[model samples]
Target chain A: MELFLLSNGKLSGEAELLGYAKRQLLAMIERRNITSAVFVPYAMIRGDYDQRAGELSQTLGIKVTSIHHAESPAEAIAQAECILVSGGNTWMLNQMLHENGLIVPIQRAVREREVPYVGWSAGCNVATPSIRTTNDMPVRNSVVLPALGLFPVQINPHYIDAHISGHMGETRDERLAEFCAVNPSESVVALREGSLLHVCGNDLRYFSAREQGFKVFRHGAETREYQDTSALRSLVPFTCH
Target chain B: MELFLLSNGKLSGEAELLGYAKRQLLAMIERRNITSAVFVPYAMIRGDYDQRAGELSQTLGIKVTSIHHAESPAEAIAQAECILVSGGNTWMLNQMLHENGLIVPIQRAVREREVPYVGWSAGCNVATPSIRTTNDMPVRNSVVLPALGLFPVQINPHYIDAHISGHMGETRDERLAEFCAVNPSESVVALREGSLLHVCGNDLRYFSAREQGFKVFRHGAETREYQDTSALRSLVPFTCH
Candidate 1:
């Protein structure tokens, strides 16, 4: 099974994280010997398809297709060489995945050595069990999405949740704290902008500008944040096997 | 205790409920012979407050002050002849109520005859204890602003989530099924757009456009939608008390 996951810092015409994102994607391809990849941009609503999909295709120079237009994911899977996912509303993207029952297929594609999957923002989030810990809203409540479980740990892209102290909100720290209270065994990887996480055959690691705490609940123990994912290795005993 | 809960019917605006709300407030006032009321507009974040508040105040034709600007709810309670709340975002409004610790005081004001309180939308929602079974997302989160336990039951407002059956979502019926699965005693009132539930001093009777079912759950019992809240009364046992 070959899989490649690429996460951009941020996207939107305003945020210029694509250069670094391209570097990250190219790095993954070079590492995995991947030739061409299919781009899945489900994070966006069905309305802005042409513009967003068109740009991503032009930007990454890959074949971008809308799974929403296809009769089924099996059809979309048929044409794809490799999978590259763009970032947007995590809940919306998660909802789309759930509404379509594509979780297992995507996992199967990776498992069957069909394609290496690359996911950014929202795509990066649902790689774990649930979408409840993200900074997005349930604008349309399809939040009960099935997880690909590519990573046993919950990846909180835009992990810092910058608006924490200013918005009178449950800060990234507090939200993770609450999540830990509910899901004790769940590990959270708090990726700041520019952080790159690489997963090759169950060996997960993070390469970034800064190393900060990746908090996890220690089974029946309390939640605490540490400097990196490796620290929580003891907590997640069987991540590989 | 003088408490007024503002609700919207299938098509009515919360502001329009002001008239019905005013009548309830008037009766509460006359029963206690009150002369002043404090107006709370904490939920008007996304609306035109100046206009809506004016119409609401004029409809009641009663003097109301915005507790939104108040430093403390005690100040709002002590100053108001009656408390009139407007609607907007529940998460935001609930955050304010929780941050300011107003739930207890508001409940106290109603119980001790200190003031008559009027609540709408988000305001009415937080009147119950657990909003975990809500149809809305915590677009924002707050540790302090838990819902008041005025009612043990959770409400799913604007119930009848998207009518698209094939859509990936837990319908109002499904959410109650989940709710009942754990807390058999938990009763969920699905308030359609036009329903105004008259929850007065331990008595919760429906006053709405249609007679919808109140899904009830009990341990070791079959979960079913009843003809009305009365059918769920056996579940509420306390309403009789």
Candidate 2:
């Protein structure tokens, strides 16, 4: 399986979507000779789906077609050479994936056919076991269904340590700690902005555009930061490269 | 029904829990002649429940007993003079409320017997029609059940407009706007820290210990700030005082 789970779609000053990982994306595209991809934009509420697809197409040099345009979304996923998931609202994205019955098809495409899956933010969230570690609000009244689970461990995208002054709410760290406390046996990989986790076959790699390290959170243990994927081997099957 | 839906329990540099609303709470207790109250501490994941109850007792000059110590939680709610909810994790608190069968009993006590209901943070989120506007992460695997719905409209506690530098995640305004986009017919009252909404029978009042205004968010409408409860009357059946 090949996957590119990005922390977010854009950085602070970059105008192009996914511009921070352009070289890596171009390398994968060239190696696979991929030309077209199916885009999942269900996480978006106020944003235009096709406009985002166009931006992604321009970013990765591929023909990105939003699944909403297809009469059969599952079929679109089944026949696509690549899968692209955008970031917006995790709850809505997960709900739409379940509502449109595209979860299994995407899973089969990524796992069995070795289709390349690229996702950022909320897209990165659904790649995990569940949407339990998301930072978005639960806007919909629908039931919380399990996610695609393409990746084995829970991940928190857009992770940060800063807090707005005088904002008396749970910080990102506090929320992740609460998640760890509730699920003591589980671990959460917190990916800061401009960072990503890439997996190819049995090899796993970590990258950060800002040269920052990722943190691992667990219950009854100190949250430690690492510059590489050495700590993730025990949680996932991929060998650190 | 008598209700005190607080934005948070404590403020910056304040050591006493619920100290911001001490005067109003004392007045309510004196008017109702309340001596003891039942505390719901399910929202607390790492904090000590008994210690929090003790602090609340000291703040209000009334006995605060945690409902977890009761032999029957529903029975305790039925016999209690008042209900106090703490601030912590909303998902766990709502799930525990459903699991312990306290939803209907608390509803009946508040609606029928007019039990004074006091809740802060997560407690305030559950008082609305749903927990969709809450700012906490959904860390549990339980189904999304309807909240207590003590308040007719949704209330977002710990609401802020500031953003941390370099964080790419959605801001509080954007998240609430997304909620409005999804639920067009509903409105969310964004309460800042050290603020609260008090309801007594047919009268409704808004108070911010820091003298701040609250904002109302709706789909395709300007999010306007109000220093009084005049704008909330159309959404709920209460006279602004």
Candidate 3:
């Protein structure tokens, strides 16, 4: 079983996210011996789902079936060996899941059955317990969608430390600290560009590109900093029960 | 007492948004004798708040007496004539409230004391019963911040009816309808640019600047389309205790 959470798609196929490990991600899928993939994208409503699926198939060198409508989701996953969820409007996607009751079945497929699953941005948010750490706001209460909760900790994909270079004081750091102070039990993993929090079966490691490292704020402990994503993952082991 | 939830500043000046009625906003404020104002901008950093409030003061020609932190928001409202909230990020601002314990007090002020409260973006989301209608994504559990329930419905501010001029089937319309189908009791208000849902002491109205309007939805009922906020005041009286 394998699952990947990406903050965003690599503009040209290069995953430029910190705390995200591309090599690790590839290895996980290889271990599952799964090539057939399903890409669920509700964010891009401008074009047909087939266009996106074809592009993913071309890029990943694997067959990717697109699930645009809810009815197609179950069938798409049935034949697919792995699931890859891309980023878009998390709220809209969650709403779709709740209304359609896909959250539970997906969890079952990924956890109990060990079917490989991957997600980025909104997808990453769904891997956690709640949809609280997402950057998207809840525009309508109609989207009361709970998360899949595969991981106990929250993932901050596209975890940008500074929006721009040489920013000001009370940075995102300050706000993150404030978050930790309020909810000490909940953990926040900040993933920068080209980074990933890798969890292979039972091996969980945090990987990053270059010197970019993400921060981890676990409950009750002093806010600890990491030099790489693997270092953060070392703290938490993903034991599929 | 009065509060004007602004999409931008200069409702009567340069900071005014694209689809709202400037004269109506000014009249609402004038009727309340709002000489002083407090700018609440928890979504943005302190620097952004400072700049936004400066613009509002320059345009309105009113003294921005205090810039209250959400942690101690009531203190800012105590002696103020009006409370104006600016737009930026709702999740971060909501996080600030959770850290500071401001949601309950702000709601209390608006409900009991009649503290005229205005919200834009994040502030607007909190004003409703929940922040379920925002465009932001809480990618993780850490992003779970409590929201204020000033209004019984959710506000999808900066509602993008269409991302591009000619796209697919109505994205915003369909998504909103989907939201209403799930949540039959709560209403969803889509305030396009330059549009607002203005609430004064016992009077709630829809004010529009250009042609843009709001779409309201309730449970098990046909969704209603409103072109002007003013008409809503009479349709739904401020009778909620």
Candidate 4:
């Protein structure tokens, strides 16, 4: 299985979507000799699906077809060389994936067929066990907390330590702490912006476009940030050394 | 029917929990000759319930009891003179409210018995028709989106226009816009920190310690900020004028 789960789609100055992960994406595309990829834009509430696919095509130099146009989205996933998901509303995206019957097909493509899967933000959120760690608002009534369990651990994508001064709401750290308190046994991977977790077979690696580190949060253990993948050694089915 | 739906609990310079709305709260308490108020601390994950009730007691000059100690929580709500809900997590609060059968009791108290309902942050989110407009993370697995319809329209509490530099995630405005887009006919009131919406019998009013205006969002209509209550005229039941 090959997965590129990014913390976010774009960086500060980068204009293109997935600009931070460009080199890795291009290299992966070239190595696999992939001709086309299917784009999952269901999570995008305020975005144009075709425009997003067009941007990805221009960036990756590969044919990117939005799955929404397909009469059979599951068939699109079954025959795709790679899968790309947009970063938008997680709740809507997960619900649409379930409603459209694409969850199992995408999972089969990535797990059994070994088609590469790339998702950022909300897309990266569904790659995990559940969407419990997402930061997006629950803008819809029909909410589905569970997502594709392609990645074993729960991930908090677009994690940040910065807080707006005088904002009385709970900070990001506090929210994650609350999550840890509720789900004591589960651990969360705090993926900061510009970071991506690449999973290839049993070999899982972490990369950052800004040379920044990622943080691991657990119930009782102290949350520590790491500059390399060595800190993720405890994760299941991965040798981080 | 009396309600004080606060955007948040505390402000920057304010030491007490409900310091900003102190005078108004005291005036209402004295006017009604209320003896005691029940504090609903279910939303508070990290904070102590008893301590919160104690703080409210000192601040409001009324006996405050945390409802967690009651043998039957619904009974506590039934016999309460007022309900004060704390601000921590909206998801957990809404779920617990539904699970413990406090929704109808609180609704009866506020709607029939004329019990004053005071809620901040998560509490404020639950006052609306649903919890979809809340800004908190959905940490709990058994999620409940619906809430007591004490307020007819949806509300986004702790609403701020400030954006962290370099953050690529959706802004507060964008999130509310998505909500409006998805639920086209519905409206959202974005309440900034230190602001509140007070519903007293048929007369509804708005207040802000920071003297800031609240923004109203609709599907295709332009989002406009207003210091007066005239903008909320179209909302159901409530006479915003």
Q: Enumerate the chain B TM-scores of all models.
A: 0.76, 0.99, 0.77, 0.98
Question: What tens digits encode model 1's per-residue C-alpha lDDT throughout A1-241?
Answer: 4433334434323234345557666665666565555556676542376566666566565656656567777657655667766666565676677677777777778767547776766777777666655554343422354467776566666654343111221235655554554455455666655555666665655555444444443335565665544764664433332
Model 2 C-alpha RMSD vs. true structure (Å) is 0.7
**Residue-level lDDT tens digits of model 2 in B23-125:** 9999999999999999999999989999999999999999999999999999999999999999999999999999999999999999999999999999999
The best-first sequence of candidates by lDDT reads: 2, 4, 3, 1
Predictions' DockQ, in order: 0.04, 0.85, 0.17, 0.86
lDDT winner between 2 and 4, please give it: 2
Instruction: Tell me the spans in candidate 3 whose CA falls farther than 4 Å from its real position.
Output: A11-32, A69-72, A164-171, A219-224, A229-235, A239-241, B6-115, B118-241
In candidate 2, stretches whose alpha carbon ends up further than 4 angstroms from where it belongs are none
At residue B24, what lDDT does model 2 achieve?
A: 95
Regarding DockQ, does 2 or 3 come out ahead? 2
* TM-score for each of the candidates: 0.51, 0.99, 0.58, 0.99
Name the runs in model 1 displaced over 4 angstroms. A1-18, A31-35, A69-71, A141-145, A161-166, A209-228, A235-241, B1-241
What ranges in model 4 sit over 4 Å off?
none
In the order shown, the candidates' Cα RMSDs to the true structure are 14.6, 0.7, 8.8, 0.9
Residue B75 deviation, candidate 2, in Å? 0.7
In terms of lDDT, the poorest run of 10 residues in model 1 chain A is A162-171
